[model samples]
Target: MTAALFGHDGPWTEEEYLALGETRQRVELFDGSLHVTPAPTPRHQRIARRLGNVLEPAAEAAGLELLEAVNVRLRPDRIPIPDVVITGPIDLDQVNIDAADVRLICEIVSPGNAATDRVLKMHYYAEARIPWYLLVEQETGSLHLYREKNGHHVEESTAAPGGLLELTEPVHVAIRPERLLD
Candidate 1:
């Protein structure tokens, strides 16, 4: 991920990060350091919105909630804001959702932050034992679904634009990659 490190000499604690409060930019805490990113581009936001819309109905039917850009506290030292998340019902006043409540986490690949999404974040989700991880490669219009198996994530399926992405766990649903881009 292309992150602009803060001028601080050392990593910030979780309490310190929370004290910063909400800001215009998106900030994630990883490895005790803060990884800050600018607001998403219009295209990125559009894709995220569309994907959320496509998933909401199915999620609701399965008693899951679809939320966007919410902080997920994976560990005491790690809090990553996924682009889209499917989880059990969360209270409106909740500051951050615990990893245990998360059913699925999705990251829409940003050109500059591809590695963070595909590598670092993927590992973090696996380590947290999150059930499902979805990776949407924006440029390629592809979707990848990873399932947690034996404490690690393994690719269970992949679909290209106009292809169907089917999921059986965390709620059964089918999505088309093109719908997310459109």
Candidate 2:
């Protein structure tokens, strides 16, 4: 499904979206809706990159890998490009991702995505049974961590700019929230 809606007639698939490269906006498909996102501000990129720097090496040491802004296949036909994802046996090495292969999914919230990140995406990720999901809010400089439980997402913890987000499995990494604001 490479058909994506740009304005009136879209909902393009990944291939179609890529074909129209260099657009000022980035779009992702979630629950069949075309989510058009604004270009990342420098602040957003900085935070995303900083988080990657902190987590990537640790994931590798644990026999896992990290992917940035990669499309994850949550179902046979549903894909949501998350800001950061960590999993074992990296497949993007081949240039495409099999979403079911994802272990953890993270998103750094933008102004347009506060509701989606905190609510809609939360349900979707929970249903997919992703072991862990992190939501980083740039405006608040906080991180919200959720872990799947009995087919639902249970809020595991929340950390502020100077606070620590501790995890027990996959890599045992603790994040410094300020890293997400950089």
Candidate 3:
């Protein structure tokens, strides 16, 4: 069998996981298991980019940086790649951001990622104590925003279609669900 096909099988240590480096697919390690997903589709990528653009200025103004393609380490064996993350300053060579440094995490829900993004990731981020969470359901044109309170995530705001979702905590920024993919 080709190494690429079965190389990542079985349990993975942090070093081996990180050594996979930059692959076309998204690879994550959690609970000593490796989870791999195909690259984001064009539509998915567009939504991520547009959303990143919307949050860039606000993040910078808040003394944070909006980033993607960076791993957020929640535990020694728990690491996942968020679609978007607003974090404190980072060294350019760093491959991971400590959960404590992450201010906000955004995940865009697509047909393939709905369950993971909405349920698993939500639970994990809250467990990591990430202060804010934004869930964008693309097909429905809706946005679900949450904030961490008492170490748990609480729904803070939501919007549908052209509706406006305004957030003031962690940073001040307003987002319209429809504009995220435009």
Better of 2 and 3 by lDDT: 3
Model 2: number of backbone collisions: 12
A best-first ranking of the candidates according to their lDDT comes to 1, 3, 2
Which is superior by lDDT, 1 or 2? 1
Cα lDDT tens digits, model 2, 79-129, are 677888898786455534665567788888888668888888888888888
Q: Write the per-residue lDDT of candidate 3 for residues 1-182, one digit (tens) a residue.
A: 12754865667888888877788888888888877898998999899999999899998898988998679998898999999999888775788889999999999887977899888888889999999999989889899999988767899889998789987867788988888865
* Candidate 1 ranges beyond 4 A from true positions: 1-7
Q: What's model 2's lDDT at 40? A: 81
Q: What ranking emerges by TM-score with the best candidate at the front? A: 1, 3, 2
Which residue pairs overlap in candidate 3's backbone?
none
Model 1, TM vs. native: 0.94
State the lDDT of candidate 1 residue by residue for 49-134, as single tens digits: 99898888889999889999999999997999999999998885888999999999999999999999999999999999999999
